[model samples]
Target: MVSYGLEEKTALMTSLTDKLASTENSLIESTGRLDRIKEAFHRSEARYHSLEEMERNLEGYQEGVKSILLSKGGDTSPLAGIHGIVADFLDIITPAPNIPNRDNIEGELQAEKVIEAVLGERLQNIVVEGQEDTKKAIEFLKSNCAGRTTFIPKRPRPEKYRIEGKALQQLSNISGVIGPAMTFIEFREGYEALAEYFFSDVVIVDKLETALNLLKETNSSYTFVTIDGEVVESSGRITGGISNGKSPGLIQKRRELRALKNELLRLEREVSGTEGEVERAKNEKVLLQVQIENINKQIHEETIRIVNIDKDIEALIDDEKRIQLRIETLCLEERGIDSEISNLSSELNIYNEEIQRLLAEQAEGEQEIQGLIESQKLGRERWEEAQRGITTRKLELATRKEKRESLSVRLKELGERIESATTLTTDKEESLSKIDQKIDGYLREKSGIESTITDLWQKKDAISKEIVAKENERAGREERQRLSEEELKEKRRVMEDIKKEINQFEIQKAEIRLETGHLKETIYTTYQINLEEEIKNLNLKDLNIDELTSSLTALKERLNRMGPVNLASIEEYQELNQRYEFLTSQESDLTQACETLHKTISKINMTTREMFLNTFNIINEKFQYLFQLFFQGGESKLVLTDENNVLDSGIEIFAQPPGKKVSQLALLSGGEKALTAISLIFATFLARPTPFCVLDEIDAPLDEVNTERFINSVKDMTGFSQFIIITHNKRTMEA
Candidate 1:
């Protein structure tokens, strides 16, 4: 048994004391929780009153709404225009009732008739000029001045007089042929016919003889025969005073009078018919006007009734709208109350759950308390038992301590006896000195061995480094050889391709040469010389043959470099190799350049992206602010960013003012988002002006201020660019 000192005993007491404190604190916390549970049961009366009031209001309102809605009858009225009231009612009716459909055919026809009556006649008139010759209509006389100038009343120049009289009769007959008559006059004597003809025609010699006589008597070089108002004929050769004849006959004037009378009669008939038609149209129009007035009066009365019906309908609709609003409001209120009730129920559930949890906790706490009481009673008994055990240990410790004191005294005497033995101490000290010297020599030898090992390690490292360098050099040389071999292989491939191409070209050239009879030899010689020169220029010996052969031998161990010979000859092979090397070098340079350019472009794009975004954001925000300033509250967006292709990547401005949800720009009224969006867009245009801006009807949707804003934006833009805005807006035009 080991004895515990006072210090150990004190530590055990402090540990027990700490455990007691922790247990007591747990018990106190449990007691406090029970107290809080007791307090909650006393404060739940106020919540019930509020819920009761809300429930009562909701009930009363619901009843009031149902009573009001059930107290109206349906209204009846006829609707006009393209559709009817009955159709609208049919659309509204849920379950169709057994009723006959109304017939409105006559009403539709009447409406059509009214429209037609209002629009007058659709008649058209056209005038065409008359083609008939009116020469016979104006009175003019003609007479022979050959011998009639001095023949007072003696012989009267009877022959010429008869000829002139007959000619006048023919002219009169021709006037009858002017309109509605088939009058033809072949002169009784051919002389008169030829004399009266307007155009030249063959006639008998009598007319020529008379013409000569007249010419002789009158002593005139030419003569003209006048019929009515027309000069019907002219003798190319005539003479004397008959050239200027007068008072040829009385028939010409009478023929003119007859033609005038016929035309006048025709005009009188036309005027009478026109007058009758005018009178008929006037009477019809008047009757239609009277009918229209009567119908208008009836329509006015009907319209008044309809307007009253419409007002009633409007009132009914308003009532319905208000009722619907009220009902909806009531429903909302009920729903709100129900939600509140639900929330209360959730709260009550929470409370119930809390109470149940508290009760469970209380029950568990009571059980724990009962257990603690039992444990405390048991622990107290155990602690008292331990106190008894400690008293027993103390008795045992007293006995053990007495034994230890006696042993210590004996040990002190032995230590003094050992200190008095001097000879043995001197021997041990000498031996210890020798051992220390041996240890020092051994340490020095170890130090020398360590230096040798370090030197060896340095030498080994140098050898290892040299070996590694040699290996690396060898590997690099091997890799170069391999690369050279690959170049040879690639060159051979290109040579093969060129050989195939040249072969094909030669085949084509041969065919062409065969067709060229005289030029074949010349063409072939030129092509052969070109091939020979190309073959001669290839320096096959300049390449590192041994290194290439060694690499090829090594490569053969892994893979076959030359599987088959597709090329024709070594010349083609060498030429193809040179071409391949040139192409490969060019390809590598291009690839590297492309990579560098791609990186540079990517960096530039990254830098410009931030700048573009910043500009876009600035423009987007400014435009939106300006749009809102004009529109009060709506949204606008950058339909396009600062990208060059605006139309391809155009963004749309979506404007929906506060409380509105639809995004359709068209659905907004003329005064709403249109002007705002237009102003914003124009402002954006001003920010980045181009060569020319063409605006078509952009200002057609704006008010004065918004229009002014747009125009000012345009004017501002015009400081740099040409602008052509097509607009019907007066303010835009004026601006």
Candidate 2:
């Protein structure tokens, strides 16, 4: 029985050993796959760093371009027309005080606000006139500015002015008037020519009565304008009642800058997202490693269990050998008792007692059997525990595999984002190029439309004039008919002679009527509108048939003398107008694009300033802390060379060493300089430690005591970092 049990135990051990070996092989294969996955993840991660480098290069390019655009004649873009500097006088003279409510979100200054401050009220039409054509001059009340309208035509000054130069001072009490254009302080400076060309003869007044008075007084030379920007031309013709907003030129550059910044920010976010994906892949890899570690630990534990089981089996065998020796002794005693029973019959009773003793020995053997059963139960428990561990590890291994697949999915997603970002950038560039190429064609079409519109307007004006003249004649004819009807009714007997005359005159009138119809048909053919409708709407009396017939003949003769009028201008104008609208839309889109570019540049500037300040602050804090530590007791600080603008400044360090007689670092000893620098270096390490740091001959200037201190400080930091210090100092090398 013992031999059979030993053989069974050996067979079970052999199977468990084989199973563990197989599990280890599977783990190794899984580890290899995990390593490959991690390598791929790391490669993908490197792309994020490359993107960061690209972004830095792009920023450098952006800055260079911005500098060029800001320089005089740096951007000679004919389409943009950025000719010269335009500085607001108010900003220079009485710079606007900060008002929280008045923040310009887009960083664009409206022309209305500017003109109101400089020229007077900007209610309707009057904003800064020099800012392109804010509205159409011909369609004065309505606004359309397709062409560059530089100046208002000159008009004669008012003949009888009421307000004089000094009287203007008293009227200035009104809320909104600035004096004449020339009165502005800036107007007297470099802007004199500009003001003279556009606003020289103009006067601004607050009240209409003041304007009238100014006009009356300015019969001397000036035209008048009310505070709301109503113009009283010197010739008595008034213009203006529409408002123009900010000029395109003022906002275009900044808008373009901001647009570029927006794009850069978007790209940065895309890169950041990809970085997150790489991190996730790394995390998945780490998780798999952890699971693998746990499985290895489990395998190690199983080996320990198997060794303990072998020891237990060996202990059981030793106990069995001792039990066999005891059994052999009992059997020898039994044989002796049988020999004695044969020698003496009287000793039969003693033999019965020996049998009872042997029965007691059999009870001891049952106790040994119970011990063996308990040992078997313990081994079974250990085997069951190992099986559960193996099952749990397998589950973990499967989870790691699932995570690997998930990482693959994330990598794919990251690749897609990169592709999309690339495609979008390419498309945007191509679209902008296309727009630039098409602009010249748009300009030509726009010019043609303007010419056609001008001719159509002239023809319409001529027709309006003719209609007004005919209406006046019809009114005169109606009044005469009423007088003539009364005169005819009073002379009834003379009416018969009049009737005969009227009948004879009617024939001549018919002939005149036919001639007038022909003239109207010719007029209608030339111009779409006519005076016929006005005449038909009127009720006329035929009291002067003879005289009217003679007048109509004179008109017919006059019509024959007049040349034919062209009727093609209207149709040509309509076609040109459709083309013009299409071109205008394209131009508007181009304008928006320019504005976006300006905005992007401005945003980049703002972001750069903000980032610089934040980095400067963090570095300053670290430097100050490090400076004091290096000195052992003295104070130090870092400050910006220019406090107002971080982007345009450099950093400055101020430090004082311990026991220094003087205030400045220039007074520091050689040893003190090395110590201060080391302190600063260590402080930086504490703030942002790299993977490895090297100091070359950093302790050369330090004495034995300070060198030992430096080496010791470096040693204390070694548990979390690696440092290589090169020095000829024996003490430093020993430490």
Candidate 1 lDDT: 0.43
TM-score of each: 0.21, 0.23
Candidate 2 C-alpha error for residue 249, in Å: 19
Q: What is the C-alpha lDDT of each candidate?
A: 0.43, 0.51
Candidate 2 lDDT score at position 659? 67
The best candidate by TM-score is 2
TM-score of 1: 0.21
lDDT of 2: 0.51
Residue 259 Cα positional deviation in candidate 2, in Å, after optimal superposition: 7.3
Error of 2 at 111 (Å): 29
- Model 1: per-residue lDDT, tens digit, 280-353? 55455455445534533543454455456556556655655665565566556556655665665566566566
For model 1, the stretches where C-alpha displacement exceeds 4 angstroms are 1-573, 597-601, 604-608, 632-652, 657-667, 670-673
Task: Give the range where candidate 2 is weakest over 10 consecutive residues by summed lDDT.
Answer: 141-150
